[model samples]
Target: MSAEPLVADHAHEVSDHGHDPHATTTGLSHIKLAMWVFLGSECLLFGGLISTYLLYKTRGNGRTLPTDVFDIPFTSVSSFVLLMSSLTMVLALSAVSRGEAEAGRTWLLATALLGGVFVGGQVYEFTAFVREGVAFTTNPASSAFFTLTGFHGVHVSLGIVMLMSLFVASVKGKLTQRNAETVEIVGLYWHFVDIVWIFIFTVIYLIPAD
Candidate 1:
């Protein structure tokens, strides 16, 4: 019944309902839940693409298949760069939550730059594959391969855009501690993209081609 306890309760209540514009009755942010649902749907989509690729991977019309043209070492480096971006994303969220605006923006920019590098690497890899006689229209296998990886690259590109948006917001002094949840939401998307790439890399690159 102390004034201090009452003040603490009021602060907590304000923190919940005041900061989040998308709060639900269950105290969860509806926006966050929606993001989770979206990601779940994306999983099914990627699953279908991966399954199709697997089915047609070796059916290359006796031409160059994905495995024949993969530059594993180069892709491995790109994958590492993308995974490192996830770490930078974590740092961004941490900095924003602590109200370190400058550090948060720095991390956000770093994450976006890393994503750009990954996407660039993917483009280079695709061009290299085409040079090696494996192209999107070269065979069913190539078509599926390009479709799957291309979708992922697009997702990464979108995530980079989101990160850069946050950076711009920070620069304009619009992003702050209250925007921490927004950063976390973007992090969810970026991490999801990165995780999907891991699966794609393991399936298409690491797995031995018989």
Candidate 2:
């Protein structure tokens, strides 16, 4: 009986039906861990930036302040567009989860396009400000405003690159059963960018500066 059981175990191992109990972790699990660590560090970075912006928001010197220069209605629309892009990003992840690669790619492209539009709007707004005499070095208010919002734009641009890459990979069949987690990771990053914009919009546009 002992010999029979041993033979059965050996047969199972030889069959390809058994998994490796001691296999090393790879793929999505590793990606999630790295993202968690990166996000934690980013929290500190954004927190310090927010604190500095608030501290120097209104220096004693006359400055091109947010209150004076911000176009509330236009920025409000841009902010809404960014927030909606987060929804599209989630839908992209959902499409991947459902194994609908084409749908996922479509949604990813949409999200990236929306991000591009948002960034373009930001560029236009900045250019308008410059045209209206609000250079970054012209005042502490302008400096803080541009630094905080400009950093957020940089993040959005990075997210766009990641989204476009994912879309291309999906088209090429590189993203498959082995890589849906890549989509989830990108979704997390895209969502973070959207949430950060929410805070930036509130601080830079809605809040009353002292």
Candidate 3:
């Protein structure tokens, strides 16, 4: 028996209850599907970066590797903060799903704050690296290192912007249980960025540079 009618009935009921429904005949919503595709492409992009970094990190060609000046303890704390933001994102989605707009906004803001802290840490680390003479043009290793980590910092910064947007929407009374899917989509992106950082922190920071 086709379950299309059942899903259609459920969607109708949700709509009548003042929820968005965000219904589609297709199993997956178009936006969500597109996000998955974008993330897939992103994986390939990061893969190339990591491979390039690994290739050149061991071949500094007389220039000091950026990894040589890494502050592992500081970055470990930053990584922890970013990972915690993913948890806050989940809480935000859960709150929105349950129609707790105030709680949702609180978690959303918290997540954004965590992300901001991580980015701030990255900026400080980059400054310290430059002070230690690890300029991007100093060597191939430094170029690859900056390129990979800089791209990740950009992604995290964008995720913070998205979370702030959701928080603003809640404050403006435009976000409710009906908009849960929106929070979920943002959460998906935020979690992906955090997960990517785990791989980055492991390979770029934890691995021995020598």
Candidate 4:
């Protein structure tokens, strides 16, 4: 019944929980948890935008129906590029996790390049749409369409900026495994953007306009 024996038993009990003494008590990294919360809020935001678009979609004047202006083939190619960027992002994360800094940076650059291509395609599409009388002020349908898709384009652009920043950090030796969690967090955002695009593409472009 010595106090020393009681203290030893308490220490053993604490260690039995398999908790890392140096890790956060919540068992998840704080940054990742924050990212999840941010993404969740984004889901609500995007959901509202999509609902608005769907509601106004059928309100377009005959001159600006989606079918008349949407370039499916061009969008298909852009979608493919964005989807492949997700793959490259995974590769980049894998490389970083494995401590292959050069390969990780290379893959990151590739991901960013592909994202750029997708954004460029979107810009071209938007310009073409404007030239064909699909301005944001043209009608309710056009406004909703521009708002929803423009928001997505801005997200992609921001993701590209993040990727480029990560690449620069990697080159500066600031992206070691000790802080590789940063890259993983950014990757999560990138993947989320790509997934959102999949939904948008299917809903806005692939389905036949009514």
Top lDDT model = 1
Quickly count the clashes in candidate 3. Answer: 0
Clashing pairs in 1: none
Native-referenced Cα lDDT, model 4: 0.86
Q: Give model 2's clash tally.
A: 0
Question: lDDT (CA) for every model shown?
Answer: 0.89, 0.80, 0.87, 0.86
- Model 1 gets an lDDT of 0.89
Residues 1-210 of candidate 2 have per-residue lDDT tens digits of 113212232222332443543222341244577787898888888887887788877762675665577788989989989998999999989889888888888999999999999999999999988888787887777787789889989999999999999988999998774577788888998898787888878876788885
> What tens-digit string does per-residue lDDT give for candidate 4 at 57-158?
878776675557999999999999999999999999999999999999999999999999999998899999999988888888889999999999999999
Distance from true position, residue 42, model 2, in Å? Answer: 0.4
Better of 1 and 3 by lDDT: 1
- Model 2: per-residue Cα lDDT at residue 102: 89
Question: For candidate 4, what's the RMSD?
Answer: 6.4
Clashes of each: 0, 0, 0, 0
lDDT rank order: 1, 3, 4, 2
User: Against the true structure, candidate 2 has what lDDT?
Assistant: 0.80
User: Against the hidden reference, what TM-scores do the models get?
Assistant: 0.89, 0.85, 0.88, 0.88
The list of candidate 3 runs beyond 4 A from truth reads 1-25
lDDT of 3 by residue, 23-115 (tens): 565646666777788999989988999999999887678978887899999999999999899999999999999999999999999999999
Error (Å) of candidate 1 at residue 114 is 0.4
Better of 2 and 4 by lDDT: 4
